[model samples]
Target chain A: MPEYASILFSEVLKILMLLVPVLVSVAMIVWLDRRVWAFVQKRRGPNVVGPFGLLQSLADALKYIFKEIIIPASSNKVIFILAPIITMTLALISWAVIPFSEDFVLADINVGILYLFAVSSLGVYGIIMGGWASNSKYPFLGAIRSAAQMVSYEVSIGIIIINVLLCVGSLNLSDIVKAQENVWYIIPLFPMFVIFFISALAETNRPPFDLPEAEAELVAGYQTEYSGMMYAMFWLGEYANILLMCALGSILFLGGWLSPINIFPFNVIPSPIWLILKILLLFILFALVKAIVPRYRYDQLMRLGWKVFLPLSLTWVVLTAGYLMYFDLLPGN
Target chain B: MIAHAVVFYIFSFIAIVSAIMVTTSRNTVHSVFFLILDFISISCLFIMIGAEFLGMIMLIVYVGAVAVLFLFVVMMLNVAQQKNEWFVASDSSSHIPIGLLVSLVIFSELLIVVGGWKYKAELQDSININLNLNLTNTQSLGNVIYTDYVHLFQLSGMVLLVAMIGAIVLTFRKRSGLKTQSYLRQISRERNEGVELIDVETKKGVKIDA
Candidate 1:
């Protein structure tokens, strides 16, 4: 009993250790996204807060906390309130299986990648529920768009992940990272990597595929009625999901915690730092994509997912399986 | 073992309650939400019983994709306002007793099966594909599915492919009279075709059309 208690206590401690930094990083990511956007648009972004606007996100949090949460009179109150909580919780929970380095993950379960996939796929629920519960036409439309969009992109993402799994042989995230000790999967699976990245963008409802929350037309999309902390929760959850996608991309393709090169100088740096660097680099690319690309039309987005990415990734999966089988390099063979 | 039993009971209870709510909820959207809850709790039960892969797959396929599709249809059709009057509506009053009788019969059949299984527990041992405790759930599933049940697996994949193609064919339409940008025409334009230079007289405009 004592041993069990100690294990439970240590697990809680580890979760705190992982979560605290992640929450802080989510805040910083929000600030960084704005600053990056401002730089691209040739404007000074949030210079009044702490040095270089480092504390801008904190100020925004405080502002949101003090603001009144206005619930719509005709809305379904329970589901309206539950939506943001679900979004925030689901966004944070996927981190349970993400390994920063060896022995760093909270839950080293066998189906870690599937757990992430499952949790991320369920993210549409929050948006759909919020939109539906709002009792408005725009939010309902937004929810419908989100449902179709997420479903379409997830098919291609599943196929791409299958391509990776064929090479790795295990669903475990750590095992995937370990398999890339000598060479990253990105070198061999470059096209799938690109598809996965773009799909990740679409999956997270980022710019260019953020049709769900297209502010210009849908008037903030599913979040049309959300206000105050509830709205802030949605914001935080969005950034967290973006960060999660970046981490997932790095892990699946960029070799997780592995160094770029296997040389002495490259290998000396710590693994977790390498993972962090890769995640940041990916995040920068995410932000830059947001800055450069125009928002996709709904039909075009659907076409890209179903017509282009779906067939391309499906073919890649077949090619990958054939290559592995031909060379007798399939794992666990 | 105590904790395992406790979690099992909790998940099963939630699953049962959500399953009931799924059928009983008046709001169609609420029913879909309850259905999602039911799937999630059942997946939790599966996970507790050492089927993590199946549990996560349940979440990914059913709660994630299927339920979202349900919500999409519910919202689009504006069916949330429909009052769920299963047996109470005036026009539907005649089928109430028959429906109840049918449900009772099914319930009793399930009860009989469970009671029989409890009495003859040894009969359950005759299963062809036994769970191998040595391998992870996914690994064992892969082994059996790829080798022993390969044809069935391939057949299911073909079924899904046919369904997908059928859905696209049913919904796809080629609408005429809509103006769409032709990339070839846009890209193939030359400077000579687009531009015309002419010397005009002092006050008269050139007849460009001619």
Candidate 2:
């Protein structure tokens, strides 16, 4: 093949490789959660679907594609339709910046962390618009709750990230991962790790912090009026965000692609494989928490965020900065 | 480079148009939403400027908090169209002339400044912005405040503290409906006394309970 053609072919192959894994992995996460929930509740979940419900997500996607979409008479038709699209699109776009391993990122921007934050922040608008456009009280309340939840959790998240940045001394995701060759920052910044994990749970609006979709109270929250493909998009976007958060947690705290064992025998798994294992483990941990923990009341949730997590993360930032300064690692120290 | 330029222009165009619509729109709620769109696009503009920190902060602070607050207040106000007419009508008549004049003045000033100066783009580019540029626009603005601008920062903190105290003093008032708890009152309460068991016996062996 000619050089240009070869380059183009390689690029296409790279895209295919990245995209296939992400899609399959996301589907697997959904399946795993279902299976885990079934085991926890002492019941079989979707065993009838292809080989212990492995194909359940594929079936779900097909169902969504063929389903009838109903636009409410009272809704602002434009915004109502656009909301889920925006939500799903923003969620997918953030994945472009997330590095799976050393050479796996799509965009590989210098400021990957900042880019991710920016994209995730925009994700809130989808919920806000969905609720507002619905012209329904339940969805509106859910949207407002989501907005507040995101804002409160996002602050602590930022502070925790500051702690990480202090350790890594670089904004690039790859550099941060590489900095963990000797040791992961989690050893020193355990408090920040916990804080970041909790904040991620809240930021993604997962169970115990999912006031936006508190079915008992808000009638499915922001997606109360949504059905068919639009609803599915929101659902996928949410799970994608959950996966993203888990991936981020692994990368930041657990050492991105580093094998746990330093010995020769355990070095069988490649770096990317190690990364996948860590992310999967983290995802299971998240799902376990969701399965076990009861939902927090709105006031209690806000209090935890603002009073507990914020202060802890801020203190972590200060401590990390002090340590870095003492060791002559901080910028301009 | 061309791709980035195109993207910048596209977002800039949307931002400008949305901002114009925000001011022009009769529906206050819709206008508030347009303002949000404008903020998001401006954050994109910040990204184009290579100010990633500022862009992220703008999204987090402006889009995530301020815009939400605006939406909340706008939704709660429940002002009808008739009430809106007063503000909207007055705004339109007064705004057009003032806006035009202001834009004209700004454009003319920009033209004069650029025209009067001999362009030294290279010299300006060579200047280390990381050293000279004030990072106030960054999310790490707090860091710079404590380190470089410590004295000014301390003064600002003191001012804010005083303001907070003054606000508290101003707002402090005794009201019947207001609920306040004293730590002494709280601590003094015995848990055993807070709960009690009561028993009552009624007529015969019919076992009527009270």
Candidate 3:
């Protein structure tokens, strides 16, 4: 191969290494989501597919593949098809910056967090496109609702991340993680972590903030008009985003790849395993919140994101900066 | 390198095409999507030029928030169905010459600036940014924004704050005969007020209103 072709081949291989696991894990995560929801409701969830229903997600994907794809006659066909592709693509690509372990990232860019933020922000287009292209009232309403909800919560998310940034004084995700070697941010920035988790829920359009797709009101929101593999793509993208948020939570607060007790036995484990475990822990909390918490009304959700979270996170940013400066511990000073 | 030039041309082509399509697209939603595409392409160019922070920020701020809001309004209203009126003949078409003249002047001015820049390349450093090539793009930009140009940065922030407040004040409505919940009053209500201990009579019924 030529030099450029060889470089391209290796890059593609690297991307596959990162993405394949993420997509596979999305399957298990969905199964886990169902199991948790079932456990909360005292029911057996998908035990028929495999032991503990491990292969259920695979079966679902197969079913989606075999099913007929129906395009609504009134819909805009180009955008209708483009939306889900964009969703899944963006969701998967954001993983390029996420460090699984020290020196394990695909793209160790300097502006890693900003790159993630940028990709996640573009995520709204998928939902909005699917909604508006449907040419239906329900999807349109859902799209409009999510656009407002996302933009509102993104402000607070940015502020909360700034608190973490101030401590580390770097935008690199790994640097942020390394800064937590002494103590995880969860101890000191507990409130900001709580707000970030909640905002993550809202950002992913999960429960307690899933006004965009409220079944009672909007009939599955933006996903209503989608069917077959299109619907499955949305489901995959959503779970992937949820997992990304979980990873982010672990990296920012729970100390990515850092064991709780740094001893001989604990230190023996590889770094990636610890990162996965932390992500799983955060993901379980997400599933539990989904199972237990009732969805919020739209107005209440807006009030929480704007009125409460905005002011609180902003104040926390100032406080963290002040505390860091007062001790003459500001990074790079 | 050849690769750099190729990538630059690709992104610039996409940006130019999308910029043109933003006005030409019949559907308002499509126009907004085109605008997003234009932003994305330009940001790609920024990133290719090694300004990763600016590129990402452009994506987040312009393509993400501003364009999403544009799509929101275009979708929510019936504006998506509105036909494109570009180049359409109107009753009074007097502004065409003035528009052409203004654009011509601007184009020539751009030409002059570019042509003169080849001879006087040093003019680019008039701002004295003191950019340290050792620092990463984010760090260098931060150093400049937070230290030397701090007051200007803060003033711009103040402008944005004032604009936000102005928007809110204009949109804020005080209406009479509307029921709104006062959360403090609702939360502070006594249990005695909420519940009545009186027993109800069998058929006569208690006057609950009283």
Candidate 4:
């Protein structure tokens, strides 16, 4: 009983260790995204709160917390409140299988990547529920858009990951990272990497494909009715999900926790730091894409996802399988 | 063992309640939400029973994809406001007695199956496959799926392909009047073809070709 108790305690501690840093990073990411947007536009952004507005996210959080949560009178009150909680929970839970380093993952399950995929695929629920519960037209439209968009992009992402899994031969994320010790999958599967990154952008509802929440048209999309902390929860969940996707990209393509070059200075830094650096670099790319790329038209976005990316990723999967089989490089073979 | 039973009971309880709610809910959207809850609870049950892969896939397929599609259709059709009347409507009143009788019969049949299985140990011999405890659920599933069940898997794939093609073919419409961008024309246009410089009087715009 004592041993079980200790196990439970340690598990809680580990979850806290993962959750706190993730929550903090989510806040910082919001700040970072704004700053990046500002830099792209040649303007100083959020410079007043702290040094270079370091505490801007904190201030925002405080403001959100103090504000009144205005629930729409016509809305399904229970579902409206439950939607953000689901989103935030799902966003955070996918990190369970993400290996920070060799031994640091919360759950080193067999189907790690599948677990991540499942959690991410479920993210559409929050949007759908929120939109529906709002009892509004724009939110409903936004929800429908998000549903179709996520489903379409997920097909491509699934195929792309299957290509990686073909090379790695294991669903365990740590195994994937370990396999990249000699050569990152991105080196050989460059096109797949790019496709995965773009799909990740769409899956996370990032810019260029963020038609679900296209503010100009949909008035913040499914988030139209949300306000105060409820709205902030959605925001935090979005950034957290973005960070999760960045981590996933780093893990799958950039060699999670692995040094770029095995030279003296590069190898000196610890593994988690390497993971963090890769994630930050990817996050920067995400922000840059948001800044540079114009938002895709709805039809154009659908075309890119289904017509272009789907076939491309599917072909890559076949090519990858053939190559692995021909060269006798298939893992477990 | 006690903890396992406790968790199992909790999940099963939630699953049963949510399953009931899925059918009984007045709002269509609420019904879909309850259906999602039902899937999630059942998946949790699967995971607890050591079928983690199946549980995760259940989550990915049903709760994630299928339920979202249901919600999409519900929201898109604007049917969330429609209150479901199971037996209250006059025209559907006859369905109430029949439904209750059928449900009762089905429930008894299930109960009989369970009770009979408990007493007849030899009946289990009808089952051909046994769970391989040594391998992970995914590994075992892969082994069977790629080997003995490969044909069945491919058949299912073909079914899905046909369904997809059918959906596309049914919904696809080619409207003639809409002006669509031709990428090839846009990209292939040269400076000479796209531009024409002519000396013209400032007041009289060169007769633009209609």
User: What TM-score quantifies how close candidate 1 is to the native fold?
Assistant: 0.92
Docking class of 3: high
Share of native interface contacts recovered by each model: 0.96, 0.54, 0.96, 0.85
Error at B109, model 2, angstroms: 8.0
DockQ of 2: 0.41
lDDT of 2 at A233: 90
DockQ scores of all models, one per candidate: 0.83, 0.41, 0.87, 0.77
After superposition, the stretches of candidate 2 with alpha carbons farther than 4 Å from their true spots are A1-16, A327-333, B1-4, B79-84, B87-191, B194-210
For each candidate in turn, the TM-score is 0.92, 0.83, 0.95, 0.93
lDDT score for residue A110 of model 4? 90
TM-score of 4: 0.93
| Full-model lDDT, candidate 1 | 0.91
The sequence of per-residue lDDT tens digits that candidate 2 reaches over residues B42-161 is: 988987887777787788778877787788788766658645655677655876788899999999999988876657555464445555353323426657877899999889989989
lDDT of 2 by residue, A146-234 (tens): 98899888888888887888787667788788888888978988888888888999999998899999999998999999999999999
Angstrom error at residue A5, model 2: 10
Global local distance difference test of model 4: 0.90
What fraction of the genuine interface contacts, i.e. the true contacts, does candidate 1 reproduce? 0.96
Q: Tell how far residue A154 is off in model 4, in angstroms.
A: 0.8
Per-residue lDDT of model 1, residues A243-323, tens digit only: 999999999999999899888999899898999999999998999889989999998899899989999999998999999
Give TM-score, chain B, model 3. 0.82
Question: How much RMSD separates candidate 1 from the native structure?
Answer: 2.9
Give candidate 4's chain B TM-score. 0.80
